[model samples]
Target chain A: MRQNSHGPIGVFDSGVGGLTVLKSLMAHLPHESTVYLGDTARVPYGTKSGEVVTRYSLKNAEFLLEQGVKLLVVACNTASAVALPALEAALPIPVVGVIAPGARAALARTRGGGVGVIGTPGTIRSGAYQRALEAADAKVRVKSRACPLFVPLAEEGWTTGDVPLLTAREYLAEFAREGVDTLVLGCTHYPLLKGVIAEVVGPKVALVDSAEATAQAVAALLTERGGLASAGHAAPTHAYYVTDVPERFVEVGARFLGRPIPAAEQVDLTF
Target chain B: MRQNSHGPIGVFDSGVGGLTVLKSLMAHLPHESTVYLGDTARVPYGTKSGEVVTRYSLKNAEFLLEQGVKLLVVACNTASAVALPALEAALPIPVVGVIAPGARAALARTRGGGVGVIGTPGTIRSGAYQRALEAADAKVRVKSRACPLFVPLAEEGWTTGDVPLLTAREYLAEFAREGVDTLVLGCTHYPLLKGVIAEVVGPKVALVDSAEATAQAVAALLTERGGLASAGHAAPTHAYYVTDVPERFVEVGARFLGRPIPAAEQVDLTF
Candidate 1:
């Protein structure tokens, strides 16, 4: 199928967590413009059922597609785990989900001591990363846990200090005992708590940040599809849309996005 | 207007957090049957905008109204703070919200050392309790803080741990410094962490659980409106409904409700 290489890459997550992926994309694919949608009204899809996640994911993808995006990126771990197959089949554009790329990165970095995966309950329960890793190497062992508090801890700006450290230890201490040399941060929000997580699991444990890996995957896919925007093209622009008021999104989203969100328009996803 | 006292009381919340309120209702008003709708698909209204919260609350109320409810209970603190007025105006039946009852309880118990209101960011930002307190007693001083992590901690079953203790201290220490004699647990989920919160605030400061206060308020309103269910009515039936899947709600809700939720019907609020 013919594609317009200049069309912006579209990214959507349950909420502002996807901005982390957008941040990496800006660094990895500088010439490609992007549109990001945060379904803040129904944020935190990590805890919802597969059917509900899929429905919301489809609506989010539809909204992005209407923007004439050349590619679709599911930046949310839970949605990627539960809705990727549905999205891949439904969207006309090439679809990239964080699970496969992050799994690949973990397998490549592990010292053959097994791999640990940490994410929201839905993502872990779906066994997306575990499946992806095992599919590549059947004998590879994977230990996984659902760290539900990490998202709230990250959003609350308690990334450091005793509270987060204790929370991290509570959730991740087992990985060290399990002898997993590599840990995949399956959720976008987990990247914000990387410091505490790293401290808990120790320095020897290689941490796989899905945002960076997903960006690399998108970059490679665009190159292969001849969908990479021309380097000579004008500087890329970023646009944000949200299903709720933009004030809180603008305020809290900066922490996740690594920069202030200049502006975001409110949208109704019912359409 | 003629009313059927046998009609069940309708309660709605953003998610399982409201189950705490329902627990209080079951204890305080044994004869009053209830139908609860938890908007789990769009849970955590605490972080969303007023417009979005109000819209969701209306949909929830409409769903309950269709269930033949004679009274409405806004069981979620964020919704109570942001959507109570809209609910009261839009619904024909009496609408009871947690904020006013909690504020009244705080004022009644304060030993003239002021009152501290703690809740979600949206609830704290709305200043609903502060306005209610001052409106009732203009000379009463009120301090409020947004304890964003409390809800997640409560749901994650970390209510008794070092993490929650530290978090509660972090958010509530200022109340002691401000000489507040009463601390209102303004969020419904807060009742679950009452032990740690009370420890942080100390024995001198009184902690008012909004679940109990709201239950009392609901009971009083029903009595005044002559809408109380008959004492001889069959064992009060409790029905649960959620916008998302029932499994997580049933599991997490049991903790909040203080008993297992036998079943919860999955629903779509779009109608």
Candidate 2:
């Protein structure tokens, strides 16, 4: 991981949902410059066909590579499940996707050999989580469910209390029945729904947030590859760019990041 | 209103959430070209200060205007609620926001003169629906609630059945109590949750989908200005572009548009 001087880390997703990953990155690597691109114009990539997803992932990687990102984080579950290989193969930089990190974390946390993974339909359907978990340890049984509403609920800033709790109960009933001791919040957006999910899954099941795990992985990679930004820069400038209105990003993002996002630039991403 | 052959219809939002509006546009006005930009990298304009939302709205409008759009539609509720005046004043083309079309449709359908409005906190806080309803006719009593989770849930693709229904029940209880005759799905994403919302509100209260209303309004605007595409164009060309991964957009978008998205291109939107 030869570091490029002043090159920003490029992180991308279909929408601002990936802010969870970026937030984690910022917290862990305070000195690194970050450039985030959220395809707010066309988001929620968890349901497209494999071929289309691969193409889209390639395009996103291309855009980031164009920006000279020293590292690329596919902070989207759907892309990670379907397009990670293509992205890694196509890009010059190290490509990290959420699924592997999440799976790794789940494997580490599970005590009863029962691990439950919850995310979008595409993620669960791809069997990526199951395969990843099994790859780490063949004995671990992975119970997967698609908690689709959690992403939207998180986006709407519905993190706690009744509605999210109720929705969580509804979405996680199968997982609860499976009685997994460890649960993986497979989507980046799921971390926001932590309280509700934790309540629904009970105190016994350890919840693993993919965002946190992915961030940790990024830190390790940067450190190992000698790409970690050295300490002593002006608070690590975060430049936020989106294909839509910046206002909404700041508004919803504050809840996600737990701070005020100063300014975001609206850019035309039509190429 | 003057139709330009080369300019695309400039549609934007605070984030990818606006794709719901673009989905409607594509369905209703297939022949019309569109340039959609979602500030996905930064999003959730719903909770920002009014001044900030206004500034972001202006920037979004300006970006779209620069793209050479014949018309502009501010699809994000927060932006429409707080920044419509500025956007309209600054832009040369006719600017349409979700509030007016949604409010008008609610007014048209409400038999008891009680309309329920659901949107982001900023949209609800602005009392945009109340004002719009009052402007249409002072007699109409507007009952509004901030359904902050609905947007994220919609984005997560939890449009129907148990989880969304449960969430809707929690959010719409007040509206149901108010005995509203119509419920306005104020956020563009809210329409995706129409089934759950309708179930919660029951058959008596008609559900007004903003995307449909906005589509109708766009149709009316095009018809009135003779900007509607000629009928001879073969099924129209639909191009999708995003600042992030196109994979996630295609996946989440198919559900929004009710079909497979042809393809999405990724573009660098850093400014």
Candidate 3:
């Protein structure tokens, strides 16, 4: 296996929602050390504007960069939609965002060139997914909706229920009408709502999780760039850092990552 | 008014929640130009440890102070519980926290010296409210419970409904069992759940909103310091800055403030 001299891969989102993407990364790149940061102090980037999301994304990326990460992943839909271009341009390390990967995956799965996307208002408004799909194939018909409440609902652990299912139906009604064959869970947080969303969109529509796809993209990039962790490296270590309370991050993040999170350290990054 | 040539008022929270306190400040002190920063990009300070919350709180305050805020409001309950002392000592400006004011108000309202407090797990565990109430009057029996889901639920606008009411009941049952005559909405976000909480705890239990009480404290401080907005001044201007998207802030904020938020700007305050 090729070896990259640089340290851990840095992944961050507005909050714990990004754990979904981090989880996928852990699964795909089991030997790679990962540094995960959830701006648990200020989360839910989905509803923010492009400029603000960009700024926050930069800050988060900078924080991760400071931790000596070899690669950066903006594991957030809103950030990916609005900040990806600037982040990719500005960051020293290679940056991969969730949007394009998810879009690519959706394009591959869609049989009729019809795809659906759901994320925060900011992500949906940015039209990143539509543009990505179109860039891949102009013939593709893309439908997008902003499921703002889904982040909060999922964070609250309302993943499977009448209320979440009903909310999912209300938000995904447009895609259902447009008859998309594949749907992208545009926001990393949206993956938690996968069950309800899958139920609402029906079994015929393939669900694309950007987290999973982004992880694959990261793995591919690492393999190509000689950044893959050396074989026999004890199961890749995961360290969690948050701007807010670590206990809550552990509790909530455990649910998202499907396992216990090690104690998180709090850092004051105002310098 | 004998006002010092200080910069704008500095307000910081773990996340967008400080916006609620900022809204109240704008309403009460319109002429006072303000700079508001929601660590929206890294929120939910409620679940972190005291050391971490304090560290983040100091960083947040330092950021606002660097922007030249004359006074600082630790608008987050978890931060207030853990970081108030450190903030007051470290910052030059007078630092105010939500817990003391809200606890005082609840103590004032409780007829039987029985007070209930609800906040995030960190806040409840810190015993900030309990200490504040007891400090006001040792005879006051303080009952505290952590309502971890309330913040996410409130952020999602699930304030008043059968589901919210049921959740409130489940969380508030312990407090009700303690026979408290007054309840403190410890977290800034908890105010949004007032209706549901009121319904569960009954109208007889006075619901003390920390935001309102904190606003009153600001008013009193300004009056004493002769920094009150000119009496004849028109509505105080409000400017919002978040580390995340401004659109979501305005949308979720509108529900909290019960009015459409005026234009909010996105800012990069990585430091």
Candidate 4:
């Protein structure tokens, strides 16, 4: 791969959720540098309207493009749901989102076309996953629930315990009743509550982490285009930017990244 | 009271949480009109730094002031905790916040000096309530815990149930261990979880709803200052402004206010 292939992969999320996707990218493709932008000043885009989300997503993408990235990743499920098409059309770089990969993964795993997808309100309301899955397989039956509390639960590091388990049960009970054999963790934060989700979802259902699927998609895309970073590339840089407090980003984000985020910095992305 | 004294009371919250306070204000002082601003564009001030929160609060206050409000209410717990002093120092209008009213209510209820406060990270970290309690009575002991997930639970409308009770227990276990006689629901959102919180805190701890106290304070202050709207004010106006997404605000905020929010509009606050 050329030096151009070694350029950083740019990822933007409403907040720390993208760090999970970034971690997966780093683990799977160690040679590729990455730049992440967390719009913490306006975090939880999941609750906002589609128009506001699209606007923020555009600004976030522009900020990352300004940094000279090889690829753009909409690591936020809400942004991916509402703003993916616009982002892809606006940027010259390949734009990857979690929804399609996740939908595909859920389709592959479901015995019954009955797939239950859970995500933030904006993502579920946007119906991106439902549309993506149905487009791939017209016969597929998709049901989605908006689990808005899961983000706060995940960020609070209450991954396990009765709180998360009960929350999971409250959200997943309808899915169980609907006989969904596959459940897509549509929101980036949902993966943190995986154990609780699995237990509540029971043994019959397969829980798909969108982060893992998205990572595989990124790797496949880069490899197919001969855009994979060379192994000879020196220790790849991983930089992080947040629109608000860097301290809280580093603190809450450490749990999401599964590593201390020492490279996180505060940046104003007014674009 | 003069015509100027009858102007609407200005209230500003980061988002819908303040609608809880606004609800109480309306019920307590049915004649008094209100002008509310929910800074939805930059919601979740709890995660942002003191400087950023202070700046937003100032902008929100100025925006409310421009509407010709008689008094200013910092309806957001995060803003009240971190920006109240700055707002009071800068604004000529009487600035009321949840912190002092909540602290007073807690002190009035505590048989012993031990008091437990549960709120967002910003409110807890600001230590405004702790300082307020101690300042009022030097011997009053205050212990605060950041129940960051509570806001999401409240907004998700999952207040009563096994999940909230379990979550409350997890958060307030330390307070129970400390044997706090009084528990203050410091955050505006916390009032929604009063049932679960009371269950977790038990019979010994009195749960003080800050919204109620703040409303009471507002009523008293207005009465003393001769700023109460007249009985014949003829259907006093209740105006609402949001920095972004008026549709979502009215949708999510109805439950918070326990009333349909029909007067909301969007406005840009550049400051």
Q: Model 2's DockQ? A: 0.19
**TM-scores for every candidate against the unseen true structure:** 0.97, 0.65, 0.79, 0.92
TM-score of chain B of each: 0.96, 0.89, 0.90, 0.94
**Candidate 4: lDDT over CA atoms?**
0.87
Off by over 4 Å in 2: A232-236, B1-114, B117-166, B174-271
Q: Candidate 4 lDDT, tens digit per residue, B1-271?
A: 3336678999999999899999999999898889999998878888677878898899888888899998998888889999988998998889999889989988999998499888888888888988999999999888989888888788778888788888888899999888999998888888788888888878878888788889999989888877788898578889989988798789889988998988689887733
Best by DockQ: 1
Error of 4 at B188 (Å): 1.6
Cα DockQ of the candidate 1 complex: 0.74
Candidate 4 CAPRI category: medium
Q: Candidate 2: deviation at residue A130, Å? A: 2.2
User: Relative to the true structure, how large is the alpha-carbon lDDT of every model?
Assistant: 0.90, 0.78, 0.79, 0.87
**Model 1 lDDT, residue B14, Cα:** 91
Candidate 4: list runs displaced more than 4 Å: A1-6, A223-226, A231-235, B1-3, B27-31, B223-235
In model 4, the Cα lDDT at residue A38 comes to: 96
Which residue pairs collide in model 4, if any?
none
lDDT of 3 by residue, A57-83 (tens): 787888888888999988888888889
Give the runs in model 1 whose Cα sits over 4 Å from its true position: A233-235, B233-235
